[model samples]
Target: MEIKIIVDAMGGDFAPKEIVLGAIKALKKDRNLKIILVGDEKLINPLLEQESSDLNVEVVHTDQFITMEESPKAAIKEKSKASINLAMQLLAENQGDALVSAGSTGATILSAAKFLPVIPGIERSALATVLPTARLHPGNHGISLLIDVGATLHCTAKQLVHFAYMGSYYVSHVLEIPRPRVALLNNGTEETKGGEVLVKTYRYLKEAPNLNFIGNIEGTDILKGTADVIVTEGFVGNIVLKTLEGASEILKHAGRYAYRKRLTWKVGLALLSSGVRQLKKRTDYSEYGGAPILGFKKLVIKAHGRSNAKAIANAIGVARQSVEQNIAEHIGDSIIEFNKQHRLDFIDI
Candidate 1:
């Protein structure tokens, strides 16, 4: 299948340069891959020439683009021709199968909301990141899908249930997990914890047909790899994601500190160098490519703003994989089935 992907060439710190290089790399990797780069032609076209410009690619010249500092609302309104906004517009127009952007996440999400239609019965979209876990799954991958990493911060129990379904289908499709175990992130594993919203969400997911609900899991249990999908509100989910990111760096700093303070510690780290490298490789956010903003008709992958060419290429691969797997269609089917089974207007029990 010739998968078409739209790239926001003006996104990220590196902008047109790295983004153009990454798109060329992806094109060279897959002969059937077609890419549309949206940015200023002067900037992007020159980068294309720097790399292999003969690959299957097109440049959609746009002088404007959203910056990280700009608010999503204002950027979309003020800059209709902005790279990120135009990328979303192209995806909505079926100009591409998927869109990948290392731009402002807020701009991406808000633009997606304005352009793409949410999956039927899904009240709002959610941002999901596939985080590393301690144990490997049937696919031999140590990762779990964490939903609502920053999309819909304040969510109701009904919406969490929507997220659960969204995350489940996504994991099953993209991660190749058969019957991925779903769990609610709460203060405790007990069904009674996490106040009324979580409690109600627990009950709803527990009874959700075709869902592999595994009850609740604590923050400590996240990396334990007990569950394949962790469902939570954007606020808590974002905190957990960021904490994990910081904690990984903290461990590195701690090792360096100990190495400087004690010769014995340095020797120990040297002995465990292979394992340390492995751990670092597994925890690296760049390896995951990008986070997928789910529930939209067309998939939108939000790569890190500081992404380099390699990371951008990986994100393109993820977007292609999702498009090939028909993730959005499957998720919509699941949501339709869920709404038919339960009237989740609000779960206030």
Candidate 2:
């Protein structure tokens, strides 16, 4: 079956040009892919012309666009025809199978929740991203799934439990991991660490039969490939994510300085170029594509804010895999069954 995706042409910092170019690249790569470009026609049409005139693409012109600094609520309300809002509406109405955006994270999440129905037994949706782990696993790219990377700022114990199951299922099906191990992010490796919410969530997860609960893991455990799915609330998860990003940047700059400052370092860099390139690829956020807002009715991918053409294309790849694997539906049904099997009142918001 053909997988249709809606791309917010004006959502990213490199709007229309990079976004459109990426969409065209995706369409060329996947014959089953079709795209609906949402943005101003004047800007988008010319870009489309640069690509092959004969591409499976549709354009939806909109006058309004939400800027990066604009308030999500105000932008959505005032700019009803905004690219993000309209793209989401199209997905809800079944105009497409998935929606991808490199726009404002706050605005995209707010609009998606308002526009799409929640998966059964899920009151809130969480963002899940594939992060490159420090250790490489067989037949994998040294990557693991990180959930709640900043969707819901605050969450209850039950919500973290929900994120665990959803993240596990996502990794297993989408990433093709079998029985992925799950862990809770805490300050300590002991079972009794973390705040009240995490402590309570640990108990719930431990008792959950379906999940492959592997006990508690600390912040340092994340990049070490300690767990398949690291479950935490958005606040902590976001901090960990940004810290890694910053560290990667620092490493890149430090390597450049070291190479220029010493002759031996220059020779070492030339010899290690292959390894360094591989390491860079693994750490590059763009290579992982966008984070999926799990537990939603339709597939929604939140691409990075400064996403370029390649990043946008990779986000489309993630969305395509998700649709093919039927991840959204599986998570909805699995959560319902999990609640029933455990005899717990989890569906309550």
Candidate 3:
């Protein structure tokens, strides 16, 4: 099956250059992949002419753009023809199988939710990102999904459980993880720890026969390969993500400072530079490209604002995988079964 991807060329900081280069790279790698770059054609086409390739890439002209500081609702309401909006519209119309953008995260979420909608019974959508964990057991060396990394600010106990279910389904189908284990982020491994929400969510998860609930996991457990899926509200998850990013930056700065301090330390730094680069690569979310807005009608990936060509290419790869896995169909089916077995009306509050 040919995979069609729509790229919002004007969505990110680098605009057409990074997006166009990424599309070119993806097309060069995957012959069956087709990409539609949505942006101002005048600027994009001239740039593409310089590439001088026979790749399967086309441009769709869109004059509207949503800025980072603009209100999401206001931008969508005023600029109906925005590049992000049109890219999503193309996805809905089946003009493209998936959409990718290194645009405003808030605008991306709001536009995707409003235009693509969510699977029935899914109260809200989440941004799920894959993270690398310490390899403990065989077949556990790959990445795992972290839900609500930066989406829903607050959630109920039931909603967290629902996030777990959705995360499990995503890991199973899209990531090909069989019987994925779900865990709640907590300060301790004991069931008695955490706040009221975590306690209630832990109890509810225990009753979910379909999921492999692994009790509570501490913050350190996340990097130790303790569970395949970690569920938490956006507030805490966002803090963890940002802190990791900040710590990485601090480490890089410290390495440079040490390297400049003395000759012996400079030699040591040179010896460890490769290892440091590898460590940074593993911890960086840009390598994963973007987080998918799970439960949406169409595959909508939100890339980082500082995304480069590599990140954009990775996002395209994720979109292609999601399409091949039939993620939308799987979410729809799972919601139906969940609703049939449980009364969702009482929990919709």
Candidate 4:
């Protein structure tokens, strides 16, 4: 089967240059893949022509695109011809099996929520991402899934509970883990922590069937791999994700500055080269591709805006794998069963 991936070619820090290159890389990596890049045809053709010969890639022309400065809702409403919205519409219309974008997180989320319906019984969607952890769980290879990393900004008790199940199923299906451990991110390890909303979320998760609810974990437990899945409201989860990103950036900047300024610093860095390589292997966002916007009818990968060719290629690969695995159907089936078991039309917010 030919797996078609539609990418928002105009939606990133590097636009057609990096996006086109990345699409070429992915197209080359898999012969059964077809890539559709949505952007200015003129700008994209030049970059794409420089790469693969006899490629199965297509360019969907559109000069319009949402900018980082524009509000997601307003831009999406006004810019009906924007690349991001067009790309999403293509996915909604079954033009592609999956969609990938290294664009504004808010824009992607808003656009996706607008064009793609949520899975049956899933009250809300989440931005689910993986983080490398210190403790390696058997079969997991040292990473944990964290959900709602800025998709909704805020969530109700039921919404947070829904996130836990989505995260659990995503890890299970995508990572091939069986009965993955799920936890609530809280101020304390106690079930009573994190105010009333979180407490209620904790209760719901704990009682969820077919889920390995491992109780609450604190922030320090994040990198420790305390659980395979960690659930938090988007506001808190996004902060945690950003904090890790900032920390990694700072370390890299400091290393470069020290290496240039002092011979002694250079020598120290050289001595720690092995450890640093391992750190990069674990913490590098490029290696993980991008985060999945869970709960949508179709798969959507939200790559980092600063993504380069390598990262975008990886994101495309991830989207392809998700399609092959039929991840959306799997999650949808689970939600349907859960609703049937509870005899409820929807989880109350």
Candidate 5:
């Protein structure tokens, strides 16, 4: 199947340059993948000459671009021609199978939630991202899908439960994990540790039939691979995500400084260079591509704001995989079944 993906060329900090380079790389990789670049043709077209510029890739002209500082709702309402808005509109119109953007996170989420209908029984879409872990899979390093990384800042216990179901289904279907273990992120492992909502969610997950609930896990357990899927609200989850990013940066700077300074430390680093490179690759954010906004009618991936060509290509790959895996269809069906079994009335948000 030819998986068509809409790329917001003007959305990110590097913008059309990195995005175009990434799109070209992705197109070269998969012949069955088609790319629709939404941005200013005047700026994006010339870059096509730098690569293959094959018919598989097309550009939709739009000079409007939304910045990181812009209000998401206002941008969506006013900037009708903005790359993110137009790309999403194209997706809503069935012009593409999935959409990937390194643009404003808030704008992407708000626009997707507004234009694209949420899956039945889903109140809000959750950002589900895969983070590296210590354990290794057969062909790849270990990764767990962390739900609600930054989609909805505040979530009700019911919403967190919904995220848990969505994350479980995602890992099971996409990651091919059988009955993947699910864990709630809390301050402590004890059932009495978290606040009212966390406590309530713990009970909900524990009592839910068929869920491989393994009790609560602390922040330290994330990279230790304590659970297959970690479920939490966006506010806390985003903080955890950013903390990992900051720590990775600090380690990288320290490693550079150590290598440039003492000869003894440099010699030690040289001995472990191979292992160090492997570890860095395992922890790199680009390996997992971008985070997907789960519970949506269509697949929408949110890449990092400072994504490069490699990252953008990987994000496109993630979108392609999600489409091929039928992630949206599975989530929709699974949510409906879950609501029916739980006797919870579905209400449109």
Candidate 6:
């Protein structure tokens, strides 16, 4: 299948430059891929001209640009022609199979919800990202999916169970896992631990026939790959994500410092450079490209606002793989089945 990715070229901190460069790189790799660059035509055309070879790429000019400082709802209302908005529009219209943006997360979520909307029976779309884990368990060598990483702040037990259903389907389809284990992030292993919401969610998941509920998984268990899918409210998940990013940055800086200290350290660095690079790649979100706004009617990928060309390219790759995996359809079916079997009133918000 020919995958078409619509990009918000003027969305991020570095506008058309990073977006355009990423498109060029993706075009070089996949001849069947088509990219629709949505942004200021004048600015983008010149950048494209500078490149020696332009592959399967096209431009869709839009006048409005949504700034990071602007409110998401307000921007969606006023700037219908904004790059992010237009990108969503193109996806809704079936002009592109998937949409990618290094723009405001709020704006991307709001606009995508407005235009493409969430799948039927989906409470809200959640942002799902991958985390590196030990290779001893299921979903170990590759990556584990964490949902609602700063999307829906307040969630009910039913909503969290739904998150597990969607997240598990994603891991199974995209990551190629047969039966992904789903675990709720909590303080302890006992079912009695955590807040009332988590406790209730645990009970619900425990009875879910489709899901492989592994009870509660502590923070320490995350790196051990105890579960293939980790479900949590956006608030806690976001904190975990930021903490990991900060720790990775600190480690990189320490490695740099060690490399500059002495001849022996330099020799050690030389020997460990490849291993360190592999570790960095494993921990890096950019390597996975972007996180999918799962449960949406259309495929909407939210890239890092500060991502470079390689990150954007990787996100496009993710978008393609998501479509191929039929992630949206799988999530939709799972949610429908889950909702029918379980009573919605059981989970009081």
Best by lDDT: 1
lDDT of 6 by residue, 115-216 (tens): 886877888778888888878764465678888798788788878988898888877876777789888999999999998898889888998878888899
lDDT at 40, model 2:
92
| Cα lDDT tens digits for candidate 5, 12-61 | 88998999999998999999999999999999989998775465998999
Evaluate model 5: give its lDDT: 0.87
Regions more than 4 Å wrong, model 3: 136-139, 344-349
The residue ranges of model 6 lying beyond 4 angstroms of the native Cα positions read 50-54, 136-139, 261-267, 344-349
lDDT for each residue of candidate 3 in 222-253, tens digit (9 for 90 to 100): 77787899999999888887886787689879
Better of 2 and 5 by lDDT: 5
Q: Which is better, 2 or 3, measured by TM-score?
A: 2
Q: Cα lDDT of all candidates, in order?
A: 0.88, 0.87, 0.83, 0.88, 0.87, 0.86
Model 3 misses residue 274 by how many Å? 3.2
Residue-level lDDT of model 4, residues 1-349, one tens digit each, is: 9999999999999987898899998998899999999999989998877865799988899999998888989999999989999999999999999999998989999999999987887888999998998864454558889998988788887778778778887788777668889989999999898887888778777777888998999998898877899998888999999898898889889999999999999999999999999988888888888999999989999998988999999999989989998888888777776667655523453
Query: How close is every model to the real structure, measured as TM-score?
Result: 0.94, 0.94, 0.92, 0.94, 0.92, 0.91
On TM-score, who's better, 2 or 6? 2
Position 160, candidate 5: lDDT:
87
Candidate 6 residue 20 Cα shift, in angstroms, is: 1.3
lDDT of 6: 0.86
Clashing residue pairs in candidate 4 (N, C-alpha, C atoms within 3 angstroms): none
Per-residue lDDT value at 185 in model 4 = 91
Q: Which has the higher TM-score value, candidate number 4 or candidate number 5?
A: 4
Error of 4 at 304 (Å): 0.7
Candidate 1: list runs displaced more than 4 Å.
Answer: 136-140, 344-349
For model 5, the superposed segments whose C-alpha errors exceed 4 Å read 136-141, 344-349
Query: Which 10 consecutive positions of candidate 2 have the poorest summed lDDT?
Result: 340-349
Model 2: residue 298 alpha-carbon error in angstroms: 0.5
